[model samples]
Target: MAAFPHNRRMLLMGRHPPAHPCEGTFMSFVENLIDQVARATGLGDNSRKFVGVLASYIFSRPDGFKGFQKLFQKAGLGGIFESWLSGSPAMRDINAGQIQNALGVRDVNAIAEKAGVPGSFIGTALAGALPLIVRSVTAGGTIPNGLPSGLAGLAGKLDWGDSKVTHLRGNRKRGSFWRWLLPVLALLALAYCGWQMRGKSPPLGTPAAATAPVAMTDGTAQSVGAPTFAFQHSGGKVDVSGTLATAAEKFQLLDALKSTFGSDKVTARLDVDASVKPASWLDRLKAMLPGLKAEGLKFAFNGDAVKLDTTALPEAERVAVSAMFRDQLPKVKVEGLFDRGVEAIKGLKAGYSASELTEALNLTTVRFDTGSANLTRSSQDIIRQAADAIEGAPAGTRVEVGGHTDSQGDAARNQLLSEQRARAVADALIASGVPAERLAARGFGSNRPVGDNSTEAGRAANRRIGYEVMR
Candidate 1:
């Protein structure tokens, strides 16, 4: 991976202008996550760097912070996490054992690989560096919607206090010397690597060894900008997450999943959001579960379209099965060129920008029912223009639907509303024949404001939705 440029100055969060896309044009999504997390955590230790990779995997979701918080908080470490941000000396240090315990040995080892470090080094590095990390992200006590970008002029504007914890535990025990210390250090250095990997812990486990023959994941399918899924299946275990269009669909889908995967193996997170496009593929979905007997097989479903992913199959098999699926599923519109690659969205204009698309969308505007994602008739006609503009800019463009709101009511509700509204737009585009993979949706709450939040007009403007071309 090409390393992002680093300088003496750190990008601290405060009342600065929103970070613009043009600022860091060279960065990729995962790389940006790594860079931001690295910057946020002060790049304390190489082991700690993997947290950036881990963060990328989790925070890639439309509302990523939810999973990020759940990763630790669900492990019953909420208070310990809080102390890390306490900004006092009492902030505790975790051990390699704790990192193993929290993330599990398997995930630690996998993260070690991603970070390009030995497995043993990761646990200790995180144990030593996480406290400083906690302080950086919660800087000024706000978790940002979009990843931070600009770092040029916005330094020292907000001097929110940080954790008082120091990295080196230099104090010596009453009579202890290097004699005792060296042995303990050596043990930590070697022991973590020696331990047998325990696969698949209940908490945010990834890449664990699974003896079971079948591992399946069923989650919400979304575009690049909205609430997408990140699933880990190992040792015959299953994980289900992401939002759904309706409760009935969730129930039917869960039943089919449990029946096929065995009830004991299935774990699910099926959130219901009315704004999601109602499942047009559900009638075919139940029948399809039985066909998941093959490994490395995945499917992407959007609206009525159901596309099979045969990337894991042999080249001949991949081509043959895709043809079979194409014949079976009429809505899939499976294009061989896009099997694992990007192609231009048909009819999209060339070199479109978000600002241009937003303006064009405004002319024919897609409007939702007040405070809900339900589209009015006015929104229907705009999908074609919006869809084309989305993928029109970059070749093989992937776009995100960013939902915004002006400050009006509860901030939390506003955030959810924005997400729903974004999805609604995305759904319309998908139903209108834009490729499902190219679009994503997310809500920005009231954090981004165009006009003054106090004014009704500004709030209305803030409650708008826009698109971004993601690389």
Candidate 2:
């Protein structure tokens, strides 16, 4: 929908460039373009290097460049590529949806897995750089032939660090000064604009002070004190202390905390002033029971504060808990909690029955790759903890590793995938010192979904590996 600049040189280059000295030229152009994008997007050193790696991988695909062009055109983002090729100083902004559309969800997930970065971060980096990279490589207006066919070959030929970029300087054959100078100037201009806008913008993560009473919908002004909240994580638990004007507000805060820190890991002590009636608070908290239960979180309001505890959770479950709170509730002061280590699986009673161990394992978060039987790197810790618990279970107990899938593709395929996933988990457990004879793998497919298959959240919930005791 947006208009973009068009490069005359690219228009003449066609769809594929011939193999010649320009191979290095093409590679150099992409390297420079990546550097420019990194500066523009404010990517850190590691992420910037990742962008280079991703570019090499994409280009190495048999039809990667052409595929990207087609994908962009299909997603209605052709204009961005046009603008980048035409050397437009203004970068076109692309959203996460557009990135997902341009690069299929599966491909994006694979890229995220291969890059070892969050999918969200991958989307962001690609959105910022993909157009420019495409434009640079196709500058002669064609996908260059004789390029490396894989990331290893491409990376071997290219330098990722401070080595200077050479070749692919466009029509000018002599000087490289203008080519380097223009991007630097563009970056400075963008930086200056950002600085000029900073004064008018409110600081992030700072809560506004409540100076006046909040007016209620019932045409009444509640004479309430200012709301103050703080959260901290230590010894495998998050401690929340806060004061809110009403019980509804308290419930809202507690719900967010529970979602972020996993209800089992959150311990809240919140106070609702006497100005708000107790009945109001009780009703609100009661209504949230189902949602809390679904998330496996615990909530209770004590005399002074809302007591929340997540100390029993594994480390992987608590990942990104603090970030979620900071991003969603920036005003709430959080201390001693900046994404730390996971709490050892404590509180598992010795000599616990197989069923009890299964229930506890269900509470732990175990993640796997999208559409792959391989367990995610993050799931290792959780599986290890489960193995420890299983080892402690009664001698005759046998644990079932049950895999389930959302109703997305064919039922037959889903069934097979689920079975493979279940087996993968069993294999992992066996490798981690759990006796192979004590564990069995089973797949339920989409038949035994615990949540709705229509919604993404429900689908995520349904696609899980469940542990069941089958003594």
Candidate 3:
């Protein structure tokens, strides 16, 4: 393998000489030596700098001469040391820090102070040798125990604050040293990566191993200036987050989503449901109910049901707007302005289909008493048409024949008269073979006025019967 720049520095510093009789196998020698030093010093299974430091320190040590010579001889590069020594100072300077780091001193100044080098040259020598020095002390297995006897007190002072002593004693098990010293750094690095990757997808477990970020043209990846609507699926429900700026915008967005995701995919939430006034296309026509606005309209889709949040939209006009949409939109899907991926509503609207209603209800003659609950001969045809209209309703349907009267007498008596009239109509249906279980009679005595009670046309409109589906 080709030598790295730092490896070449190690070679220049007399750290990685080839061995004898290995016949030009410098690469093998370097690898084996690194492996041995790493194992002996407990750094082989760890970081890259450990080996670098070990090599520099061993080469720089005075006693290391014969050891390195043997290493060179073994690797068949014994003749290259003199040639390596002639290299530039840059190589020396870089390796110096490696050695110093290995030695557990902060930098070259501490090493020089320990070595008693003073004056301008001390800085130069320390700078050049810092890497090697650090390597030597740090590589020697925890604390260096063999300082000169004369410096025992000073060495004792160094030992008091020394991490190596505590680490060696406390970290005796295999892999314990790295577990004690490096795990926190590794964990912190991992946490930083995780924070950066919050919304983005991470790899199976590690943030550092995450997939590359994807660019979303429609701004799904990140929220820019535009509104971001996202759905998170959990349990059986999907929580929708983010917002639409205005009522019309909210409606448009909701309409688009209902069109794309089939209204069943998500439940919508809004801050102000009843207070929003959704603008309509007819607002421009002042002559057709001018000054009216949708002031309190708010809505959400929850699976099969679209719920209106009316608490915020407390105004009458807004309430009407909400009711209108609630009553109508479910019948037909309306594609509005903000159509992105919207297509169409899936099926025909659900309500009273004329064919189905006719198939369920039986019909014959229907009659009403003249100005009372008494039967009359002329009213049979209109009653038959009403029965035929509801004939197709399902078997369990609780059909009602509701009656109303004009303002003619006391409120109490009028109520009784209208109720009797409804019963008369219901009896006619029952007589004509409509099942009694499916019929109900109700009466409103001028309570819900469809037209003015003072006019003849109004009275005619008030005296009417209606059918409703109540299944």
- Please tell me which predicted candidate would have the highest TM-score against the true structure: 2
Top lDDT model: 2
What ranking emerges by TM-score with the best candidate at the front? 2, 1, 3
Instruction: Please list the Cα RMSD from the true structure of every candidate, rounded to 1 decimal place.
Output: 23.8, 23.5, 28.1
Give every collision pair in model 1: 87-163, 210-235, 223-439, 223-440, 225-440, 225-441, 226-440, 226-441
Evaluated against the true structure, the overall lDDT of model 3 is 0.39
lDDT of 3 by residue, 297-397 (tens): 23322212233334433345543543344223332221111110110111213465643453333222223545568755334433444444444344466
lDDT of 2 by residue, 372-399 (tens): 8977544565677778888888888998
Looking at candidate 1, the ten consecutive residues that score lowest on lDDT are 151-160
Clashes of each: 8, 19, 44
RMSD to the native, candidate 1?
Answer: 23.8
lDDT of 3 at 37: 35
Of 1 and 3, the candidate ranking higher by TM-score: 1
Q: How accurate is candidate 1 locally (lDDT)?
A: 0.49
| Of candidates 3 and 1, the better by lDDT | 1
